[model samples]
Target: MTEQTNRPVPNPCVGVCALDENDLCIACQRSGIEIAEWGVYSDEEKREVWRKIHLREQGVLKE
Candidate 1:
C-alpha cells in the first residue's frame, strides 16, 4: 500500500447537499457520482478528488 493509503481521508461534504446544474455539489464541488462513490474510494482516489476540488476553487479547473 502507498503512504497515502495509510492516512484516512476525510469526506469533503459541507452538508450543503445541493447540486449545481453541472451536477457538482454546491459546497464540496464534487460531482453526484463522486459523492456517491466516496465511501468506496481509496485514500489516493479521495486525495485526487480533493485536488480537483482545490483546483476548482482556485479557478484552475472550470469543470
Candidate 2:
C-alpha cells in the first residue's frame, strides 16, 4: 500500500472560462497560459499562483 503525503489543492476554476483582453481569465483571474499549465505545475507553483489570484481578488494587484 502506498501512503499519500500530498493532497491536491482545490481548483480555482469557477466555470467562467473566459479570457479578457489581456489574456487573463476574468473569472478565476489566472492567465490563460497559467490555466493551461496548471495541471503540470508543482504545489509550490500552484500556491504562488493562488497568492496572485488572491491578491487580485483583494484589489492589491492586477494583470
Candidate 3:
C-alpha cells in the first residue's frame, strides 16, 4: 500500500471586506493590511497569507 498526502486549497473570500488599523479581515480575521499591500508584497508574502487565511477559515489555525 502507498501513503497519500493532502493537497493545499485556495483562499475563501467571504465578502467580509472591512479593515481595522491592522487592515485584517474583520470577518475571516485575515490580514487586511497584508491583502491590501499585496500589490507591493512579494510572491512569498502573498503565499504566506493564502496559507494562513485558509488554515484560519478551516479552524485549523488561530488568529
Candidate 4:
C-alpha cells in the first residue's frame, strides 16, 4: 500500500464526557458535526480535521 502524504487525523479524545454549547469538543475542540461525520469522511476530509487539531495542539486555536 502507498503511504499517505498529508498528515493523519489525530485521536484527540481526552476522555471527557461533555460537549460544549457549540457542540465542539471540550478537549479536542472539534465540532459535533465534525465528529458525527468523521466515519464517512474521505481521507482528504480527515486531513482538514488533522489541520484543525494540529493548530489547537500548537496553541494557535481554541476551536
Best lDDT goes to which candidate?
1
Clashing pairs in 2: none
lDDT for each residue of candidate 2 in 1-63, tens digit (9 for 90 to 100): 223227676679999999989888999999998899999998778878899899988988866
> What tens-digit string does per-residue lDDT give for candidate 4 at 1-63?
346655565555677747788677778677788777888888778778878877866879764
Instruction: List, residue by residue over 16-57, the lDDT tens digit for candidate 1.
Output: 999999998989999999999999998778999999999988
Of the two candidates 2 and 4, the one with more favorable lDDT, higher being better, is 2
Q: Where in model 2 is the C-alpha error above 4 Å?
A: 1-6
Which lDDT tens digits does candidate 3 get at residues 1-63? 222213333344577788656556767567766656767755556567777877876878764
RMSD (CA, angstroms), candidate 2: 3.9
By lDDT rank, best first, the candidates go 1, 2, 4, 3
What C-alpha lDDT values do all the predictions have?
0.91, 0.85, 0.63, 0.73
Q: Give the TM-score of candidate 4.
A: 0.62
Model 1 pairs whose backbones collide: none
Query: Which order, best to worst by TM-score?
Result: 1, 2, 4, 3
Whose TM-score is higher: candidate 1's or candidate 3's?
1
Count backbone overlaps in model 3: 3
What TM-score would each prediction reach against the true structure?
Answer: 0.87, 0.81, 0.52, 0.62
